[model samples]
Target: MIFELQNDYIELFKLIKVLDLVDSGGDAKKLVVEGLVKRNGEIELKKRAKIVSGDVIEIAEVRIEVKG
Candidate 1:
């Protein structure tokens, strides 16, 4: 899936929440804390990591490509 950026960036957890990947922000944060989320193929633990255009985020089987 592709997520179009409307600003300079979006927070990792917020992105997951906005995309409806999880039930709530807390769940998204939990996923990140558990190392279940990846940013550019590396496990991302920062829930508030800035996700900019061209960043690729993966969670389980869902892959989201950020586009400018």
Candidate 2:
């Protein structure tokens, strides 16, 4: 699943909120804590980690590619 990234850049938590991937900031943190999300194949544990253009976010069986 591809999600469009705004401004080709986004702060981590803001992106999570904007994507609707999680219900809220708390949920976002949960997902990260559970190791349900990956950034470039590494476990992303920080819900506030910045996500920039060209970053690949893998969640479960879905892939959200970041583009400018």
Candidate 3:
């Protein structure tokens, strides 16, 4: 299902923290450390990796598409 996004493009892992997708930044960090975040169908663990337009981020059953 579509997870409505409030940010068009964000740092790969900051998306998790800023969106409140996780409990806190620490939790978001943990999610990345545990390899739970995916970018464009591949597991991405970089917290500062730039995630630009057309990127797909998935966590559990949530899918967020970055659009300009």
lDDT at position 54, candidate 2: 82
lDDT of 1 by residue, 1-68 (tens): 99999999999999999999989999999999999999999999999999999999999999999999
Task: Return the top candidate by TM-score.
Answer: 1
CA displacement after TM-score superposition, residue 28 of candidate 2 (Å): 0.9
- TM-scores, one per candidate: 0.98, 0.77, 0.80
RMSD vs true structure, all candidates: 0.4, 1.8, 2.6
- For model 3, what is the alpha-carbon lDDT of residue 62? 84
**Compared with the true structure, what per-residue lDDT tens digits does model 2 show for residues 1-68?**
55566675776656666778778988777887788888988998887787887889887887888777
How much is 39 displaced in model 3, in angstroms?
0.4
Q: Which residue pairs clash in candidate 3?
A: none
Q: Sort by TM-score, best first: what order?
A: 1, 3, 2
Off by over 4 Å in 2: none
Model 2 TM: 0.77
